[model samples]
Target: MKSKLSFLLLSLLFYHYANAQTAPGFKELLDSAMVRDADLKAQQTRNKLTVLDQHKLKDVYLPTLEVSGMASYLNATARVISPELNLQPFLNIPEGKYNNNINVSGFSGLAKADAKMLLYSGGKVRQLNKALEEKRQSENILLEKTSDEVAAVISRAYDQLALVHQSKKVLDEAKRRLDANRKTADKALGYGLITPYDHKKIELAQATLDSKMAEYEGKKELLLTQLEVLTGIDKERLRLIEPVLVPVALPAPQKTIDQRAEIRALDHGINASGFKIKAEQTWWIPKVQLMAASYYIGLYGARVKSSDNIIPPIPAIGYPGRKLDWKPTNLNIFPMLTAGVGFKWEIFDGREGKHAIETARIDRELLQNQKYDAMRKLTLNQANNQSNYNIANSQIALKKKEKEMANNALVQAEKEFRYGMSKSTQLIEAENDLEAAELDYQNAIFNQRRAAVEVMRSTQELDITKLY
Candidate 1:
């Protein structure tokens, strides 16, 4: 038979989950998805942007300070302190020549410090901060939406698997009964108690039973495969613990539809849109900042000769002789600090900022409307699904009663047939009726269970965290 499980295996994605067990019976699956689900991962990353924006707010509150220094070789012209140039009468002799300036190779160093503090920003910082916070909440809402969706999928898969497995017992019993009937038909024909046509009829009934069994088996495998993927279990070894059926409880509903993750997400989006409008509106405000820098510099000049104190560098003729190599401190600034306040005042644009503000407002309004629209639609969906579930539940009860009656009638009919008090066609008809009742009851049961799962999803009660 062609495998019906192909779609189950076709999904090519996985989320990491800790193998650590939760209390009672919950898998770490939900907790793991919080960190490992791709969408959640992305959303959490987006939430970090808000934290960064919050830090930026801290930056605005604190003064900016910076320290910088530089150390490098600098060559300069030699300085000559000549008595003639000084015109000092007391010292006619030439004074000592020393190049205070950097020589052929000299260390040039400087250190400076700077600080800047913001004076004013016309509410732009606050608006921007709010916008960033909105974005962060939007990310959280998005993660919640993803989580709700995944939970619904898991519930559906579980329900489907349960339904298919439950039907297997019914189909197997039917198959056994059909086999026994077929054998009886064959023996009766050989003993001349049943005609060939009667035997053929038995064969047809047996064929139908076989087909039903095959179908049930196929569906069971398909559902099992889908469930395996959803629950992150090995298909071969995966065994569904018996489902904890939720007894029907009267839901304490909120007057509004705020429980749905989608609505919450939309609410966050609305907030974001509002903040975007605020951000756009504040574009006219001036930006202020503090700038600070510190540095160290050391001077390197003439070298001290170890022997004759005769430095080789003197530009008396064609040669500028020996130059000094100073210490690293002489070339680098030990500490330098500079502080200033910087401001940017907006002048005029082509009304682009105004238009952006208008656009943001429009987007906010649109999303607000969309949110209500979505809520209305979802509310109607949930209502209809719940109604359908109630109807299916009623049908399950009715079919159960009908099955019980059919079972009793079939037993009586078979007893009558064996005593030659009933016709072969009557016996077959009773058997068929019993089979139909069994199928109906089973189907109703599955439908009720499946619908119950849908109801749980609608109520947002499928969180694996709360499940055992």
Candidate 2:
């Protein structure tokens, strides 16, 4: 049964390869996929955030400038009284001259420019800068990791599409052979050389093949669709370029776990957490800043003029009102410049700062533990992938040998049947065996490639440039 199945599968595979057409290369497919994959596009965009972070880091110690202005109007009124007494009648004077009423209104405006720089922050500035740097490092590694994952997806999808296409061709060939067998059985039955039961058996087998073909055809359509979606190629235009067969080298064992982007990202996170702890501890220390500012105030409609005044004479003394001098001297605008230093201290904050420092410390420790765990798991995974790769390589050799033996058997069976020395059933069985062996050999090649892909993924080397 296994031999028969292998025969059908091998035939389709051969048909697929023999009739394969020229199509897009792996590089083109990958480039197209990079443009269409939404996840990858988002990650690529996010990768630019690191540049913004770096720019901010560069200005960590630079002063910041701000401009401000405002305008308003004001009104005021005033009243007052005075008393006087005279003993001599020769001099005339007014006692009410000392009394007066005044009213005023004006417009006012101000504009200022200020600059401030951090003089000291108890290492908080340095810690914050370091944190940003670490964050950028983490993001960079994340971008690389996303790229690797996308490459792996494309590699596997391409291989599967190729395999399915080959398999469909093999199935078509199998159907043709079954049709021929059914025709032969019909002829034998009419000549009374074979029993009706024998003819029915051939019919039954053909029916089974047709059923299997239908199932495979559906799968082939799905595979084609997947290829279309992955490569951003039109379904009608998407065709896989044949890949050249080559021996894959065994992956070198990793002596350390730092090669993976995920591990490196974790390391960056640990560094960032350490910086955060430092920043939190700084809350208890004083922060100093230097500041400079220039400002101007202007007034409108604020002029003054001299006013004439007169008063009635009193019973004992008489006097004339004199002209009073009224002048505005502050109408001229002036720019005031000032420079100073400022300091701030949190003192205490209900233990929130302490809790923050503790939280950061714990987070750093957690990342360290996570790194250790990842190293162990990744090491094991690498070993397993290597083992699978080796196993797949060996399977190809075994399948090749099997195919050779099956081919020889089929030739001998063909000759014997022609000479009336072998039964028809034996001849057909030999044919099936040869076909099965061939199929196994071809599948073994794909299996080996997939195993190598796994090894690359484990080692963080699953790049598009390494596509088979």
Candidate 3:
């Protein structure tokens, strides 16, 4: 008995696992799509770029350090220094050698280091940094807008696929009803209660339902393939579990146009342009920069040999006999320091600064116009979505009423057919009406959800996290 109980429990566990493997829910698909979709991943990468831009702006005021070094070999022709007339008479030197030149030659080395810090730039650095920061903010907002757009696509696709899935179910049930009616018609013909023509009518109806079911199956497969690609799931294994939607109260809205990410990004862009104009205006302003440098240069030059030293300098008589020593001051060292400040004023640039300032002003105006236009269009879209939502809700009510009436009519027609008071055609018509009404009701629900999504998207309130 204990073994039997264990086996039953295992069977139940396997069944549960199988059920779990059948399909994925809307939330799961959405979560997977957000991470796997290529476009969304590209947008997310911009968040890292914003961080890099922030760091760049944060370090804009910091000073920079630079170090430089150089070494070179030197050479010179022989030279002889001419003796003075008074010295020549004392030393008794020949008059021919009096104008002789002395030889001079060698290697020289130098090393230098410097640092520069901005003392003042007429607020140019500050304004440029501000512009970069605002530009980064604009990019970040644009990234968020991309995310919102992608999220809306996922929402709409999921809802449309769900609607198609529901439609397939309705068609399946209709086919089943037709098949059962065909069996009844066969029995009626066997009993000679219905003619061959009536039986053929039932067969024709079955054939029509079969065609519709085949079409719906093809459509369902196509939709499943789309979902598979979107969510990065295997096409063969991918299925979408039906979502049970509950009523959700719409969140309180801000001014839709103002809160939209597109508008906010445009505002950031305008602010950035204003800062750029200030940056350009600083072009002609007096600027101050603190500069400091330290350098060491080793000098190496020929000196008179100790033995050749005399009151009057001697000229080189033979090259092999003697030559000046060639040498360097030191191997490697830097021993010098200097400090100073600099001021610069570019008083003229052929009116370039003026042109730049004008360009910035024009860009600001263009952005202002664009923001207004975007707001107007978004406001119009918001109104339309609200209208659609209201209409969908009303249509749902109408569909529900139609379904109720069709259901009642079906019951009445079934009873009449039972007593031979109604034709099979009348009963079949009632069934088709009931099926169509249910399908329309499902469509109304789907349309209502889509409208809500649109309203949220236009208002910049569509948070994927809360979609579940």
What TM-score should be assigned to candidate 3? 0.77
TM-score of each: 0.66, 0.73, 0.77
Per residue, candidate 1 scores C-alpha lDDT tens digits across 1-468 of 246465444443221123222121224333433344566567677778778877887578677666565666665555444311332244342455432443345656666666677767667667777767776776676666677766656555555555566566666776676676666666667777767786777677777777877887787677666655555555554453444333243254433467766777678778878777777876778877767676655676634222211244334454444434444423334555566777887778789889999998888889889888988888887898789888987887898899999889878876775554554566667778887887787677667666655665665554343333
Cα lDDT tens digits, model 2, 1-468, are 999999999999997765444476777777888778888788767868867776876676699999999988856655546422342355455345555545445777789999999888788778877887898888878877777777777777777666666666656766676676667666667776667765666676667667867887687678668878887676655644545444466547453457888899999999999998998899889989999999888767764322334233444445544433344544545679999999998887899989999999999999999999999999998889889999999999999999899879967975664444655576567757866787687688778888988887786777455455
- Candidate 3 lDDT, 1-468, residue by residue in tens: 999999999999999778567777666777777778787677768667766776876675579889897767754444445443334545455664433334444566777888998778788778978887888888878877777776777777776767777777778887776676667667667777667876676676677767877887787787777777788866654663565443334676665568888999999999999998998888888888888898887646533222232234544443232333434444434666778889998888899989999998899899999999998888898899888878877888898899899889877975664455655677678777878897888888887787777778777888655555
* Clash number for candidate 1: 50
Worst 10 residues of 1 by lDDT: 15-24
Error of 3 at 224 (Å): 3.5
Global Cα lDDT for candidate 1: 0.63
By how many angstroms RMSD does model 2 differ from the true structure?
10.8
lDDT of each: 0.63, 0.74, 0.73
User: Which sections of candidate 3 miss by over 4 Å?
Assistant: 1-25, 76-104, 233-240, 245-254, 298-334, 408-430, 463-468
User: Distance (Å) between predicted and true CA of 312, model 3?
Assistant: 7.8
